[model samples]
Target: MKKILFTGGGSAGHVTVNIALIPRFAREGWTIDYIGSTNGIEKQLISSMPHVNYHSISTGKLRRYFDLQNVKDPFRVVRGVLQAYRIIKEQKPNIVFSKGGFVSVPVVMGAWLNKVPVIIHESDLTPGLANQIASRFSTRICTTFPETVNAFNNRKSRYVGPVVREAIFHGDAARGLAFTGFSKSAKPTILVMGGSLGAQKINRMVREALPELTKHFRIIHLCGKGQLDPTSTHPDYRQYEYVNEELPDLLALCDFVLSRAGSNAIFEFLALKKPMLLIPLTKQQSRGDQLLNAASFERSGYCKVLQEEKLTPQTLVSQLREVSWDKDEYIQNMSRFQQNDALALLHQLITETAK
Candidate 1:
């Protein structure tokens, strides 16, 4: 039987694209193998998939800051490369696909050593450190944004637009309302997402402004693990550490979104036509990718940008109000966006590239 090896981890964004493509390959009777760090979130996300054979390896984060771990991580990455090489050699997969995270670098190198064709997907406007390294080893580079195509300056880069999950498009608004216990006759609902791990600053400010905010909109906050505030309670407000199957319902329920500027999440929001108030991570917090993503979205009129550096309870409330007021205009801009069939394109690329 034909087989394929996939690798990406460290964050939900890295694995979500793989998740969207996996079911398609499985339905076609292809054997699927996944490589990820032992305790990373990818393991938890992929563990429930019965058809996928999951393999764990040592992984080192590609950090920009000085830390004691930086000295030790190179050794771990080398170990991961060797382990990945052995696994790829044994599995002899026809092709390896990567979604561009720290864990994926070793996997791409292993695929190169094994003489297997590799395809890497970049979700950000500019490539991350891991993807930049993997790009040299990859047979082709798939990008979510059209501008990223020019960054490569090579024949390998292809713009496939965004690969959004099919389930996201099938959300039920009524179910969402029921799940949140929100009333249709009451205030509009706003979903606050701080990413998979949550954003502390955003969380704090949201709660701080709840007294003024709840008067205008009911709130549903996905506060990330261990970030929940017990003191903040209201008739119209609800908070979750995270949501799995229920996320679609929550997305369906919200009339507006307050979120961090992660590329994957923003694209999904854009696809859903949800007006968003984006507070991107500051340059110190990230490599400024979120800043660029938010800026791009703002330029396109799909969302309003709120810099985290300037984030305060008052600013949050004001920006959200502006987004709500300009909601129809944002929707009109989003309506003009036509995304290609990214999943199908990737499937075809893999099928054609695989030996």
Candidate 2:
């Protein structure tokens, strides 16, 4: 039987595309194995999946800032590389697929050292530090954004669009309504997501605007881990620390979205054609990739961008209203960009690269 190794972790975004591809690979009877940090969200996610062998390795965060940890991280990285090399040698997989994270660098390098072909997927317009380092070892680079292809400057790079999970397409709105106990007669429902880690600023502003927002819309907020406000008592509002199996139904019920501009999340929103108000992380919080992701969606008329500096309860309400007004336009723009075959294209690349 054919075998494939997938590696990526840190945030849920880094592993989402890999998660989307796993079922397809398994269905085709390929042996799937995942290498990720022991404590990262990836392990929590991938380890739960049946038929995929989960392997944990040492990993060091690749921070751009001058942290004291930087001094010790190189050693961790070296250890991770050695661990990954050992796993690759033992697995003898036909190919390694990377979804770009700090943990992925070692795996990519180990694959290179072991003479295993590697295919890496970058979801942002620009490559992250991990992907930049892993790029040299990869045989092919797949990108979600068209502009990202040029950023790699590699002959093997391809703009294959985003790998949206098939489960996303099968969301049951009625089931979602039942879960939320939201009535169809009430104001339109708005789903708020602050990414996997949640956004503090977005959470604060949304909470502040709840009095006004709940007047016009029932809110379903995925507030990230440990960010939930227990004091919230609005009958029209429901908050979840995080969601997995219920996310599809939640997306199905949402008439609009208030979210951070993570590429995977936004693309899922786009594929579902949900009108969105995107609040991307500022340069201080991120490397400004979210800003670029948000800007691209805004330019395409698929969503509205709200800068961090300009975020306020009043402004949040106004932007939400604006996006709701333009919902049809956004949906129309999204419809023009058909992504139904994106997952198939990526799977094909993996299979062909394996051969």
**Candidate-wise lDDT, in order:** 0.92, 0.92
Candidate 2 is scored at a TM of: 0.98
Candidate 1 lDDT at 141 equals: 94
Ten contiguous residues minimizing lDDT sum, candidate 2 = 179-188
Give the per-residue lDDT of model 1 (tens digit) for 176-220: 888878777557889999988899999999999999999898999
Window of ten residues with lowest summed lDDT in model 1:
179-188
What TM-score quantifies how close candidate 1 is to the native fold?
0.98
Model 2 regions lying over 4 Å from their true place: none
The Cα error of candidate 2 at residue 352, in Å, is 1.2
